[model samples]
Target chain A: MEYRGAPQATLVDLLDRVLERGLVLDADIVICLAGVPLIGLRLRAALAGMETMTKYGLMQDWDREVRAGAQSLQKGAALLAGQAVQPGLH
Target chain B: MMEDRSQGQVQEQARPEGAGGEAGLYVYCIGPALGGGCCGVTGIEGREVDAVVHRGLSALVHPCPVQPYQTANLEVTASWVQAHHRVVEAAWKQWGTVLPLSFNTIIRPEGGLSAADALRMWLEHEEGALQAKLDALRGKAEYSFQVFWDPVVIGRQVAEASPDVKRLEEEVQSKPRGLAYMYRQRLEKLLREGMEARAAQECRELYGRVARCAERVHVSRPKEGQEGQVMLLNLSCLVSTGMVAALEAEADGLSGREGFSVRFVGPFPPYSFC
Candidate 1:
């Protein structure tokens, strides 16, 4: 219900207006890019990339770190077992 | 149409002669020619933004290379978009009314005509229409209104409201395990249909209420909602500045309803209206 202004919180709404809705000029004078579809695709990709980074990128990195830690723990356990066996052989 | 008095003025003022590149005038928005320049606002890439005037209208512009401002970098693109919006917002505040151009709207110089001249001539030709639009949008701003509903809640309500769905729910409960599974799927489908119908009715009622508070309403495609919510209505409303409170009051009422949430943002420079 709060009437939000154009801040970072409303970037999606701002982009919708700035990218899609506005006064269009005659084709002859304006430097027309391919069209809205192309621009929309590019912006959507960029935004999707950003969302992925914010939402899952950190979690993926954390998952890797946790797996590495577990691997190191396993290696330590193997090393301790090897030491225990070496003493028995000696 | 006015004669082109300043043949090289746009080129000279927008960019340095023999700058050895094809540069174009990137227009942000257009407003009534108020004589005084654009309060020294800077636009994309920190380029100084000024106005190209023609018969009581001005197009706020900055000089840039002929290429569109685009990039693979999300941050860069976002910055450009934000800068474009900032300039337009500034113009809107200063000029009292403006017709905002989409992002990266660059006016390139045509054959034998400088970009600035092309802009000026276009403005002259479109003066009547542009002025009419600006007049119509003078005291209004565009607002974004989106309604998201909790699908789980709406689905439950639909199930309780529809007799068919209630009967199926009871049948599913009474049937054998395997048959009950099949009945559950059928029940879900029926509930989904009821939900869609209910959603349509809610949308119509909400649109009617919100439309009354605004001068103009543009229905936009609803987007996917976050978490468990589903977007029901997305609208861009052109509301007179004085009527913003009334619009907010309506939004507040909608948001207060159980299972429904509203996103009402703006006072934007009538971008959709344009």
Candidate 2:
């Protein structure tokens, strides 16, 4: 995963900006590879459009829910995934 | 003509990437002049790269197929992306600041215009704006900073401070099973909200501190990866090349504080700025 210097910019970071942040010249020049829009990759598995979600005041609520789920539901998920049991969970 | 190009696709029996037959220009970035000699960088798919000068500005491009680089197969895609970045990095290393175009930005003959001609025409039209950006970005590079906090660590810290949560935890342990379940739920809810609020507040403060050192600061979406961590701030900053170390030092200082893991990357051509 190493490139010449600087820990080979994380694929997620590079991909996120590669298509999403740059200047778009027009529609005609934009081509899709394998029927998938280059920028269509989601940022993370569960959280989608985090910036947009945050902008509309939705991320805080979602964050709260996700954090709470991490605290409680992670135990069940961990069990299912066969991860080491974390302490202090009933 | 467009129909002809689309229909002329040659199918590769085993390759999944389809046909990339027609030669087109893959535009990497644009800069002022770039002086004499080629950048000596290879473009996507190992194609030899050179610059096309137009009215004092030069574009680093290579003859790539017009087809988009496939994303379905990540291994192939990653190599292409790495190659793309390598070329831009080469250009930046040799010729200071560059306005980087996005990956897979190919220009093919459309509306009877040749690929190079179309590229030249676009450069001509955007010459003034492009030059302005190049001048502004000269001697500057983009750096990325990401701050993440371990949820367990932050939650434990928050709980230690919140008396209400302490009382709830005690109740959860002592009360009847059904009632304790409710209390535990309530406790988890409060802690989650508090930690989220604290992260947001910390993000604002961190961005302010980092912004002072940068000419342009772009706040990006926080990326959540690990199960027990939350991204506090993700920023791409444009700063003078000389100030990058100072910025990293600042990040190092920030990382020394508890519950914060900082990822700082760059000296990259100002991709976000362009």
Candidate 3:
């Protein structure tokens, strides 16, 4: 097969950091989604504490995260149904 | 509240799968396609898991569409879990080329259909994107390897090698920086160097082993990052169903190496293959 752009390694690197082990919801960030907890543990704590960390740079990329979270929600719903992703602004 | 949801089950009469009343959620990978293989596999809810043909392709689901699982406790969720696993297991049968979605991915309910408008809307918006990704991962699967160190073994070796630190090891019992503390630092450094080197070495060898077998190799951290720099190697191999044996054999061989292990978990939808 014709290899695509950047090496596969590069994309995997980005995905690992972005998707697989990205910020998970933990207690500190125990935000709910419909009712279920959005995240799991440690990162949850940090996200829960995001408001408090406004003084710090933790929330520096807040907007981007919200967008990603929103995307995940819709994608999650569709993925649950095994539907293809709906094209978004992204 | 949970009880109410359980009670309000919009269930249909149980029947053998593909009976038309029983439906299943067939999956591909990160992206969805109009149709694909899905052939010669069993459906897995209660009976045989299979696919219910929709568009031109079949969505793999339980052969017995409706699973009449009689459980001891109405409230207990064991049957639900088992039913879901059944779906997953059947999907795995074809997961090599097809990336099966997580269990319970029915966009439409059994004996139901997707909202046409929403389906169209999503397809219109995301079809290209999904297609792009699907095209990208057309033939590949994810693989990983992790290595760990035995700190005890290192300590034993260190104790044997450096006799000079023996007295210091005895003196600085606890508290502030002492002889024992210093010896530990040396051990840590050695471990770091040794493990990292070992990790790198294994990675190079692995890359070489799967060289022709893979279209691409993605290296990620090992499952254990702190002690071991987990090298997650993702390979996009344009493989035939038959070549799985070759991949498995290679992995099995790698597993016999020192301080390392290999895990083979897919034909899973190539999330990264594309």
Candidate 4:
């Protein structure tokens, strides 16, 4: 509510990520959501619907999110690499 | 890069290189107010590069050809980075409020106007962040106090806290699996809590010492990855920058205990406030 602290988006999001549901894999999850408005709904449902949360289950979810982030990062990397070849895009 | 060929450096050369574009411009950062045109940096950099001064603010930028951005290695990229850094560094030193954008933001041909609309949203957000930090430390200069535990201190302290050492030799002689597991968990928690308590105690002590000398203090965690417990207690003192050394000396007096240490870095860009 008060804007006196650190920038809301960076700090609030980071703290929320740390204390609550924990960190999100940026690359995997957000890339798909970049053009889609559904990232929140999909991610929220997946997390809320988690059937069991044994340590292993927790790790599995972590892995899935990280894998998605990795995929997103790969896409960005490829785009950057493609930009390297395109004289016009430079 | 062609100059007026001072003393005929360009003219005297047997093979003159291609004329460099005096046409180039450097872009400092893009924020909302840049709709009109840049109000170039005036005296510091020797060039007349200006900001796109609009809405009572501006983005100091330079125009550049789009071709070089495609390079894979960081060649043309380096020049832009250096130029931007120069502006930012000067602005920080000169005491102007600026929101630094990450490197290499460019306007597509004729897209500067559209860029301003988006820029407005972003600049407003970052500007709010800047103003918050500014207000937080309005008259203050930052001070940092760090305390690192001497290995001897950590060992002695943890050794004193652990009740299991007696059990280590006497009751747990056989290393019972169940008890050992419980013992390790408790030990870890105790050790962590002990270290944290000491760190907290030091922060309070440091805060007390400097509260007299400073208008306000804002603490921050030491950056991660360093080995030492890097317990840093940051403070922003509203006194003139002239008081920095005295504050450091005062901090040094308080931090002089065996396991504690103190250092100060600033008159900086007011990053903590921002």
- For each prediction in turn, the share of the native Cα contacts (below 8 Å between chains A and B) that it retains comes to 0.38, 0.13, 0.00, 0.00
lDDT of 3 by residue, B69-131 (tens): 322221222234334434433444444333333322333331243322323333455556445
Compared with the true structure, what per-residue lDDT tens digits does model 2 show for residues A40-75? 452233253343344445335345545654654453
Q: Which pairs clash in model 1? A: none
How many angstroms is residue B102 displaced in model 3 relative to the true structure, after the best TM-score fit? 4.9
- Write down the TM-score for model 4: 0.43
Q: Determine which window of 10 residues in candidate 2 chain B has minimal summed lDDT.
A: B5-14
> Which regions in candidate 4 have their CA more than 4 angstroms from the true location?
A1-90, B1-48, B54-59, B64-83, B95-147, B158-189, B204-221, B225-243
* Each model's total of backbone clashes: 0, 0, 36, 26
CA lDDT, candidate 2, residue B221: 56
| Candidate 1 positional error at B203, Å | 0.8
**Residues B1-274, model 1: lDDT tens digits:** 0122133223323433355265689899999999777856788868788789998999999877675665544445556778889899999998889999888788888888889998888898999999999999998988888887776776778778889988888888789999999998888678656766677678778888888999999887666554445567788999998999998888888878878888888778898988
Q: Over all chains combined, what TM-score does candidate 1 have?
A: 0.81
Ranking by TM-score: 1, 2, 4, 3
> Over the stretch B1-274, how does candidate 4's per-residue lDDT look in tens digits?
1232222233322222234322223344333342433333442225455555544445565544331122211112223334444565455444434444333333323234333343343345456543454345434443333333343355456557667643443454466889977776665555555555555555566567776666555544332111232333434444446666677677556556655554444443333333
Which TM-score values does chain B get in all models? 0.91, 0.87, 0.46, 0.51
Ranking by lDDT: 1, 2, 4, 3
Looking at model 1, give its docking quality level.
incorrect
* Candidate 2 DockQ, CA atoms: 0.10
lDDT of 2 by residue, B183-251 (tens): 988997888667655665676677778887899988765544245545566688999877777777778
